[model samples]
Target: MIDQEDLELKCLGLIYTMVQNHLSDKQKEVKAELESNKAMENIYVFKSSTSLVNDMQVGKQGPIATRYAKSNKDISDVVDELQALLSKNSSKEGVTVDG
Candidate 1:
């Protein structure tokens, strides 16, 4: 016959294992959700940035070009530099930019 103390210890150990496994599974789910959210956020930011770039390209020929030609050129150059940096980093991470 099993001793009562030994039986209780075994039961406690089993419960602890079950709880640990459940927590581990929950942690994995949370991590996956966070990764998915981050990817979605990155996509949103990329789209917005590209849209801004397009708008700026158009603005170069608009009234802003005449009023602030030098400033516009400087901002366009900065945008190009940042885009190149983003492209380099994204390529290293296996992300392709369509725009």
Candidate 2:
């Protein structure tokens, strides 16, 4: 059987390792949540608009534009614009190599 001091030391070591593991996992979770919030912020920025582009096509199949193009080009244009803005912001923040 292990001595009392040895048992105490083992217990302390186990507790310390458990705390470290728990903290590491918690940090990862928090980081994920922060990233999620950042993406959400970017989405909010994308959606914000003015009366100028208010009539813009929410999707491709609207009424007139899609009736003519009959393609997803319009939506693709908006998505491209958003992606560009995201890219620009990331670039300004020194984030190259867009993931």
Candidate 3:
């Protein structure tokens, strides 16, 4: 029989999965947009398109890349902390869930 703890654990797991998926999706979208904009800038520019694209790509991606990495790490750390807490509590109380 499922209990309150089990339900809570399941919900937490689902929420964690959803958050991870959302982050992954957002990172991909951001990267795609950066690439797309860089390409569009190149296409619209006539002179110095190569140099322009290079500059634009770097300027656009630098801070965004850093922010993405930081945000990803932050999310991972939070999820890991929550997972550890749940595991610790479950083990201490001898709680087990069956898939």
Instruction: Give per-model TM-scores.
Output: 0.33, 0.29, 0.31
Q: Please name the candidate that would achieve the greatest lDDT relative to the true structure.
A: 1
Model 1 lDDT per residue over 19-81, tens place:
121346777686457547843453322211111223334664553442454545545655665
RMSD value for candidate 1: 23.7
Total backbone clashes of model 1? 0
What's each prediction's clash count? 0, 0, 0
Which tens-of-lDDT digit does each residue in 1-99 have in candidate 3?
A: 235354543323212212232346777786458557843453321111111122223565563322454445545665566656567768888985332
User: Looking at candidate 1, what is the lDDT of residue 36?
Assistant: 76
Residue 89, candidate 1: alpha-carbon lDDT: 70
Cα deviation at 63, candidate 3, in Å, is 13
Off by over 4 Å in 1: 1-66
Q: Order the numbered candidates by TM-score, best leading.
A: 1, 3, 2
lDDT of each: 0.44, 0.43, 0.43
Candidate 3, residue 7: the lDDT equals 59
